[model samples]
Target: MSSTTRAARPVPACPIRPGEPCTLCQVDVTGPQDCGLVWLVMGDDELRAGVHRSRLAAPGRR
Candidate 1:
């Protein structure tokens, strides 16, 4: 019998938070929609879903 181990998938961090500071805020913006983090999260379905779920879970969201 042979045993095999599967590698774990990488999970992206959430991009935005209702109250916490964002990565874009720490740097200067060259354009209106120039945030790299936003671009990354928006482009990825998993990351975008994570961000959406977080927003819904935030306090006073209901």
Candidate 2:
């Protein structure tokens, strides 16, 4: 066991069944603490496939 291995883990494709490839990418973000958050992103066909994390509720900027 190593820090790199512990920090990162492969996320298995969801609903693995029949004949279908999953549209997913996985990366492990970890360090000294748990930062209670997980993200699901939708890609954009415009501008190099930009990524944005959807807000849980009302969006605010400061």
Local distance difference test scores for all models:
0.63, 0.28
lDDT of 1 by residue, 1-62 (tens): 99999998543332566445443453675422666767877799998898789888988763
Residue clash pairs of candidate 1:
none
lDDT (C-alpha) at residue 16 in model 2 = 20
Cα shift from native, residue 61, model 2 (Å): 37
Off by over 4 Å in 1: 1-15, 19-23, 30-32
Candidate 2 per-residue C-alpha lDDT over 8-42 given as tens digits, one digit per residue, 9 for 90 to 100 = 56433222211222334234534212222222222
RMSD of each: 12.7, 13.8
Worst 10 residues of 1 by lDDT: 10-19
